[model samples]
Target: MTSSGTHTVDAVVVGAGHNGLVAANLLADAGWEVVVLEATGAPGGAVRSAEVTAPGYLSDLYSSFYPLGYASPVLRGLDLARYGLSWRHAPDVLAHLMPDGQAAVINRDPEVTAASLEAFAPGDGDRWLHAYADWQQVAEPMMTAITTPFPPVRGGLSLLRRLRTAGALRLARRLVVPVRKLGDELFDGAGGPTLLAGCALHTDLAPEEAGSGVYGWLLAMLGQQIGWPVPVGGAQQITDALVARLTARGGRISYHARVDRVLTARGRAMGARTVDGSLWRARRAVLADVPAPALYLDLVGAAVLPPRLVEDLAHFRWDGSTLKVDWALSAPVPWTNRAVATAGTVHLGADLDGLTGYAAALARSELPRDPFLLVGQMTTADPEHSPPGTESLWAYTHLPFRRDWRADEIAEHVTRMEQVLEDAAPGFRQLVVGRHVAGPADLERENPSLVGGALGGGTAAAYQQLFLRPIPGLGRADTPVDRLYLASASAHPGGGVHGAPGANAARAALARDRALTGAAYARLISTANRALYP
Candidate 1:
C-alpha cells in the first residue's frame, strides 16, 4: 500500500525535455510504469514556442531550425508526422553572406550546391561534389557511431570495415582538422571556407580550433541531405508530438514538479523527492535529463560523489552564452545582397576573419564590437509562422560566460546587434514591428538547463565530446550512481533535439535489469557496461 503523497513507478524521469520524454516513452513501451516531472508548467524545456511579441506571430523562444530534428532516428521511429508534426523545409538550406554583397547558398541538389561554389573558384564545383561523395560513403555508419554509446561495438566496427586501413587514418585526421584548414585544402575561394566557418561558429569553437571542422562538415552535410526544416506550428509542435505519443502509451507527466533530491537507500537510487515534499519511488531507475553540474552538485550534492569525480566536475567548462532577438516584422528584410532574400538561414560576420574575431573576443571574455549572427527567417521556412505578408525573424549571437548580467548592458548589446544587421540590410530596423530580447539572464530565467544560454548543453570542444562528454568515463548513459542515469544533452551526442541520449539511457537501464543474478552478476555487469548501446 502506498502512503499519501507517495507513489511507486517502475521508473521516474526527471525533466520533460525531448530526451526525458523519449526515455519515458521507451520505458513505458517496455511495460515499465514511468512518471516524468518537469520544473516548469510546460513540458518542452527550451523547445517551446509562444507569441511573445504579438498575438498572430509565433516565435520559437529558443531553438528554431531542425536539421538534426528531421534526421533523428529516434524521432523518425516514433512516427511523429502522424501526430500532427509537419516540417517546413526552407527553399534553400543556408546562405553565408560575403562582404561584397554576394552570398554562398547551400541547395539540396548536389549539382546546384556545388555550382554555387564553382562560380567562385575554377574547379571547386567538382571538388565540392567529390568531397560530398567521400562523406556519403561514411555518413550513415559514422552517424550511427556518433549516435550510439561510446565503444560502439557494432557501429564503430561497421565504420572501420567501410573505411579499411588508409581510409580509417584519413577519417581520423579529418575529424580533428580545423575549419580554416579544411577550407584551404578543399577550395581556393572565400565562399566555401566561409560557409563552413559559419557553421563552425554555431558552436563555441573558434576557426583555428581542432575538431571545428567536424561541426562544419556535419551541419553542411546534414543541410545538404535534409534541409534545415522546422515544425509548421513552431518548435512546440515537436514537444506536443512527443507528449502525445508518451501519454498515449500510458506514461504520466507532472509539470511544475521539481525534483529537489535523489532518494537513495543502500547505495542505489530509489527515486526522487520533489520540492513540494512529494516522494515518488522508482522501482526500476531514475533518469535525469538535466545538466551534469545540476545533477551532481545541486540535486545529488557533492558529498555523495567520489572526491576525484567532484574535483573533475569543478574543471568542467561550459560554452559561451547567447544574446537573442526575435522580431515580428512589418515586411521581409531588404537585403543588400539580393541572393540573401530567399535564404532560409542567413549568416552574418562576413568570412573566416570576422568569425575568427568573434570567437576570439568571446574567448577573451569581451563582447564583440561586430558580433556574428545566425538569423532564422521564420516565414522563409514556414509562412504560417507569421501573419500573411508580415515576417517573423530571429537572430542570435554568442557571448562569453558571466556571473553578472545587467539589463542596461543587454539593451546596449541588442542595439549593437541591430546596427550590425542594418549594415547588411539597410532597412532591417525599420521593418521591425515588434521585438523581444533575451539576454543570458532572461534565457536562464526561462530554462535553467540553458545555463548561461550555452545552447549545446555544454562546450562541444573535442576534449568535451564523445567519451569525455559531461565527464570522462565510458560514454554509456549510465552514471556511477546505481539505478540512475544521465540522459540529457549533457550525455553522448551532446545537445541538439536528437533523442539518442534518452533512448540510450533507457537501453542501459533495461540491460542492467536483465543481468544475471548472484554468482554471474559481476560478469553481467561488465556486459551491461558495453551493452548500453542501442
Candidate 2:
C-alpha cells in the first residue's frame, strides 16, 4: 500500500505517530480522503514496545503508563477496545519509595490512598480526600480547558462558571502555586507532599517551580480517579488500535515515507514531498505530527516562515535529556518494603530534599549524583509484558543534554542508576537476566522527533505553555502557511499520550473546510496570524 509516485488526497498527515494517526482518523471519519505518511517502517513513534533486553520480554520503548490516555476524551471516544485494545492495571497505582524503607502509595480507592498517607501522618488522609473533592468541582471544566485549543472558548466559559462556586480566587491561587508549597499547605506529613512532588517530577518541573502544582495535582487526581493503566500486550497495542481504526475507515498510510518538505504555494501548504522524490498532494491540508522546530525550520524552511517565528524558535527550550535502562528480570524487584512490590510504577528519590537537589542539578545542566528514577514494573501491570514469574522492568532518569555520551559513560551511569535501585530494593541487580541501555542519543536516533532525548515535545515550563507553546501565537493548530496544522506534542496542551493535539488540528482542518463558514474561519485565522507574526 506504500504508493511511490504522485497521489492526491484531501489531507496529507506527515508522520504516523499517534497524533498523526489520530488526525488521520478524525479527518477520515469526516469523509475526507486522508493519507498518512510515516518515516518509520512501522507506526507508534515513541509509544512503542520491543524485546530489547531479551526474548519473551517486552519493554515499552519510551512512554509506558497512560493515565492521560485513559482520561483523554479523544482516545476514549474512539472505543479502541473493539480493535483489541485492552487496559491492564497493577494492584496499586504507584509508589514513591524513600531511602528509609518507607513508601507512599496511591491507589484507585481514595480511602486506600488516604489511609496510606495517614499511616505516615495523622489528618493527611482526610486532607487528601478534601483535595480530591475540590478537584471534582472543576475537574470537568479543567480537563476540557486543558484538552481543548487555547482560548478554550467553551471550556474557559465553563471554568468561569465553576470558579464562582469553586472558590475562584483560591482555586486560581492553587493553580499557580508551586507543588512544594501546595503539598506543605495541604498535608502535615512528608507522605502527601512526597507523593505530589513525585507526580510533579513526571514533567520537567521541579516541586518548587511555579505552576508545578497544577501538573502534580492534575496527574495525582487522575491517578486517584483512573489508575495508570497500560495496554494489555504492550504500548504497540494502542498504536495498532489507532491504525486499525484508521484503515477500517478507508484511510491509507504510506510507511517509510519521510516528508522532506511541506509543499507550499504562495502562502498555503498544498502537499508534502518525501525524501525519495515521491510527492503526495493534498487538496485540503497537510498536518505535521513532527516537532515544532522540525516542522518550521527543516520541513517548511525558515525562508517562508514569519520572521518572528524564526526568532521565537531560536529561544525555544527543550526539557532535560533522558537515559532509559530496560531489564529482563529473573524475578520481581526485591523491594525492601513489600508494599512497593504491588505497585506498577515506582518513584525513587530519597526524600523531598533529595528530589529538590536532583532537580536543581538538572537545572544547572549537571548530572545528578543521585538521579530521580521513574521505574515501571511492566509485568506487575500486565502479565503479557514478560515471561511467567519474571518481571519486565524499565527505569528512565533525566540527564542534562550533552554533545557526547560515550559508551563507558552510559555503562557507568547504568551502574549508578542500578545502585540507586539497590538502595531501595536489595538484590535488584541480581534479578536482571539481561539489560539494555538507551541514552539520549540512542533515543533521538530511534525517533527523530525526540530531539536531544527530550520528551514532552518541548519543556512543560510555564513560559512555553498555553498560548506560548512551541512559539507565542494564536495557539490553534494553524501555522503561518494556510491549510497546514501543527498536530504534534509541540502544539498546545503539550505532551502525554493524549491525542488532543491531533484532535484539535483535525477539528481546525474540518472547521476550515466547512461549506458555509470555511472561508470566514480561514480568513479569521489568517488575519490573526498576520497580526501576531507581523
Q: Which one is best on TM-score?
A: 2
List model 2 lDDT by residue over 435-472, tens digit each: 99999899888888888888889988888888899888
User: Residue 167 error for model 2, in Å?
Assistant: 2.1
Off by over 4 Å in 1: 1-4, 515-534
lDDT of each: 0.85, 0.91
Residue 306 of model 1 has an lDDT of 64
lDDT of 1 by residue, 112-221 (tens): 88988988898888888888888899888877777777877787788789989899899889899999999899888888899888998888899899999988988898
lDDT of 2 at 126: 99
TM-score of each: 0.96, 0.98
